[model samples]
Target: MATVRTLRISLVCLFCLMFIAGFAYRSLRMTLHSASSGFYLLHSAPHNNSSPASMELELQDLMKVIEWPEPPGPIDYNFSTSPFKTEFHMPFPRATYYVGEYVEFLITARDHHGRLKTYGGDYFQAKLHSPKLKAGVTGSVTDHRNGTYTASFLLLWPGQVEISIRLVHSSEAIAILKDKRETRPDKVYFYGFFDGTNETMECNVELAGPDICKYLDAQTGESWFCKKPKQIPCNAYKGHSAGQSQDILTQKEASFLNKSVKEKLISSKVGTFMVSPKNNTNDRGICSSGLPNPNPSGFYYQDFWQSRVCRNRAFPTPSNVTKCLSGKIIYMFGDSTTYQWWNFLLDLIPSLQRQELHMKYPAPQLAIDPENEFAVQWQAHQRPLTMKYSDKEELHYIANELDRIGGAKEGLVIVINCMAHFISLPIRFYIKRLRSIRESVLRLIKRSPLAKVSIKSGNTGYLYIHGSDWLSLQLDTVMRAMFSGLPVTILDAWQMTSCHYEPHHLHPGPVIVKNEIDLMLSFICPK
Candidate 1:
């Protein structure tokens, strides 16, 4: 009995030692993981297929693992993807490619020293355009994770099509963009004016100081911080405006970001080719919600966007648009890019006239066609909207405005876009705002199942430290991921703008905007 008891005690001691060792190992591993992970809390949760809360927890866990491209070594200009050194050519090089066929090309990334890069994360925009025809289309780029990329463009028209590749950002520049974006929200600052006083303070999406005033939105849990003024109270904050942008890029970093290297065209020996005649046949069903987003979602042929996700229709005249939007209450909520849609519609339709709201610029604009029995309104989303001084009261949270609808009415059309103004901030901040909006969207859908809602993806623009295309791509990824599996339409303006022959603009030209509006209207009146 004595021997047995001694053996049992020894076994128990060994078990305890093993348990303690395992616990310590796990703790250390988690510490290292948290230190290296992206901007989100790390915690484990059980997967429960029955609950959305469980799904969201899982989604966040997935987001925690979504790593942006990082440089393998210290930032060096010699290691960055170089437009002058990188080369692209047709992998097959056929004599004549027919329309409706894919024109595939291979790109090999090289550094400034003309040395072959071993990894791939370079932002490249590939397009086949005919300047004479005013035709252009974005190519779908596939990275092989081994420094090689494939850009495939669908030949939509028969003509002399030239291939142009622009190195939008080097992998090193993207690393810099990721670092500055997650760490330095103050790069692009805002101005906060105190009421009845000549006092102003620098404001931002994230700031920390003993002299800072923090404003937290209870509904969305979104926080904004501003440097405290000398004499004015935090409550005295009245008007808001955009402030000067402080350069955060170092001289070494700026070398990779100069205009000469940034968005610069690479010289290619693969000259223009003639496309043979072929019918552009698409059997895509009528435009509706929940269409699968295809690669190279659509292309511009003769300056008009053709969506492959759905059979997009065109509202050619004022009567066509009026007929489609008749008996609808359309609410456009977003930054200036989305506002362009409202502006475009108002300009196109003579019956829709602007109402005298007597409000400030960038305020809630309403246009009504009483005879047509329809109304269109555009309101900018809440804070972080950087514009010339505007009234603080004018900015409203999109989720709040969405909730105020109290169950949408029939023929209700809602377009939501809040990504551009958010690129400067951390991805976590954007996620929080999206969660609030998602919840409101759920409730809105629950109340009115027939309500038409569409989310316009971010456009391609901004190539600096504060707002880089790479940074926007990160947020855009999160937005698409968060809103996935929901009943909403995504106007893929990202691909539209990226592949266009025209220059990249935050506010894309009329052709792109018209295409976006057409896609939205196609969903509204899918005949």
Candidate 2:
């Protein structure tokens, strides 16, 4: 009897030990998997490490996963003689789609003689608008090259969503599609100090002397210029112009927008308004509750996601703004368009105190609001940038800058956009830069799951010939796809800047900039 009792006790103890061991093993495994998910998603299954050169070769091979839209090749027909006439056909005409369903359409181009142009090199801005909802979403444009193109969209809400289409790129993209020239914009935006006062100027300054470039005369002074001294380079303070705005909508353009004349708007039914409080999954905030542009004027906030915080309010009050940005750290890297976003935030939220850093004028602007406990940093990418930056700013790269900050726990938000400068280079160069940042971002989120990432999509700026809006927008799509796998939220600035009554300006004016910042704020504080 004693021996039997002893065996029973031993068995019970062994069973309890095994159960605890299993639970602990499971717990550790879950933790590790969660930490490494982003890395594995970006990288591949674990295998034997390769040589450094081999590893780079592997990265190059794997990074080829993102399929970039091929720039249009030389077509058999001449665009000058046979300009394209736009037409969009929905995949399911007169159908109602539910939230999260993909909305796709086919766009075909007809030539001057009213014939289907059998070659594709056109770029169109595809958007969904719900005036009542104040929500908009930009669709993907795929050039089929056989004259027809595909515009794809994801239905983000349920309601009466309207489909508005605009031909952002005229037939010009076809000619410059291959041998893109280096035509820069003529409009000059620069900020400089003559003696005491510093201000933003639209400088088209004349050369007064070898050393003195005359900016604005005290009387005729609407703009400012660097007082030319041989030492002071007049062009040094000059900002890169993205070319002039498309002044008047062409007869074809007018036909495309006005239904009575040529174009017609379509209404789509998104079955219901069913946006969650916040979807941290893709970091797309409350998209369901968006209020589309009431006047439905100009390109407004329209993306896969809508702003949770700005549905009813243009911007948070000074007192509440700090609260919205509390405990956040923002990193902005790109050209002036991106810097405009950073500047907008700094100017709008007065409570968010900025600590002046003695860095170059525009490049390394750093500010921290102690009250809100949020920090913002802007770093310019390596040169080919239009604006003349300080020597200190030239050494910066997005990947290295991100490394310097290390990882953050729900505190870091990185915004990357360098498309304007990259227009002259081949798409492959842009792809390489994007892949490098992608790997770094993957490693970052792997170490810190709570960190947030954002990409500002490039738009159809008024770069007439040298830079093709169609090409730029296509590159933007590639960038979006590259970061699609990671936990990044795209701002979809392309549609925001395009589709507006306003000219396709590279540096969008105040109203557009305001909307851009509001959308970003919504992402940071999706209440």
Candidate 3:
């Protein structure tokens, strides 16, 4: 009896310890999920040596690469970088340039007071383009950290090309954008509608307190919160919609964002010069996955993107596009940019039919080419989206959707674009979200090594206070860093949009989209 009582007591003590351990683990997971962008959760498996601790360590490494340099002085319009005062000129001017040669420009940043800047933090976009030919290529900008920079362009086309440098943002303006973006999660608001009532309340990713209603995704641990409706219960929340954009910049800060300054082209002394092709035949290797992105990745000549990274194959005709897509299962997930790819295909392929699921605006869509035996689907990635109104049920996290596919099958092509909507959020949130997607991608690849995964880099667009090209560049930097070493194809839309002669747009026009899709197809049909 004494031995039995002792054994029973010992077993009870062991069970209590196990319960306490489990509770601690659960609390830690919840805290991480709620604090960041819900990248890790209590229920998700630890695939391939990836644990919470391991992920945190990896994040720290990425943080170092994306760390932005802070401006040295206080906000003063007189001290801010000025596009009108700034000037760029060819450091080594030549009467004629040959293909495969580089054209370098010396950029001198100046303040509104016409004084040469003594420090560097200003954001400038540089490109070489031929307006008549509709040809352009992004130039590489090298900051000297001493108010001077270098814009280097690789001459890929044989024609007259002009150099352009645009001041996207002054260092002072960027300082304001950075401060508000990190601390002001409520700057961009959303609305929550209550069922059976006309009442709508403000909703957001960071709303907290006892009087708010929270909607949580159990699988992913993602949460959305809204101010509780006075007349309806929290469960009555029926839909989500984008609300007004509240400007946080003061009048003085707005001055830095003036039309004359923001995205304004700087004075250039260089004129358009002719470029002669290389003496020998230039043959680029065939397009394939895992190829490193070349500087200025590709250039436009005759309105076609000539990729330095791959020997791009064109699907110029509708029949050509259909043939390449046949027998393939394509899944595109993210914002409107990814949707544009699907739309482009639908318009291009005459035989492709849209399978109407009665979806709403910015809805998940399905299209099939029955004769070709191929299917394509596009879904908007979850919250931080800026749609005027979208059903909550339609928004799904990219990582969750990737997992549902459960180990990629043959002929599967997954293209992901998640950077545009994430620019307004904190950098850590973007990092965590990308980390989760990276893990999911790894799982898919591990199961089947042949899966073709492509990540579309965010493009240059939006010169406003809310979604600036600088912000897009910042997140794009993090995204590339996070996915480094992975066997994925980066679509290089950043370079594609930056170099294009067309006006900067969040959703680039058909000409640019055509190049983007063609580049994607090159990877799929490299032969």
Using all chains and alpha carbons, the TM-scores for the candidates as numbered come to: 0.85, 0.57, 0.88
Worst 10 residues of 1 by lDDT: 34-43
For model 2, how does the per-residue alpha-carbon lDDT over 109-166 read when each residue is reduced to its tens digit? 7655657765555556677656665666666678887767787766655556666666
TM-score (C-alpha, index-matched) for candidate 1: 0.85
For candidate 1, the per-residue lDDT at 83 reads 93
The models' CA-based lDDT, in order, is 0.77, 0.52, 0.79
Q: Write the residue-wise lDDT of candidate 3 on 163-278 in tens digits.
A: 88898888888888888888988888888887678877898877867677776665555677888877667766656887778888788987877777788899976777899877
Highest TM-score: which candidate? 3
Better of 2 and 3 by lDDT: 3
Residue-level lDDT tens digits of model 1 in 245-313: 888787998888787888888877998889999866668898878777877688777777888888888
- The TM-score-based order of candidates, best leading, equals 3, 1, 2
Stretches of candidate 3 off by over 4 Å are 1-50, 280-283, 406-409
Q: Sum up the clashes in candidate 2.
A: 20
Off by over 4 Å in 1: 1-66, 278-281, 463-465
What is the lDDT ranking, best to worst? Answer: 3, 1, 2
Worst 10 residues of 3 by lDDT: 34-43
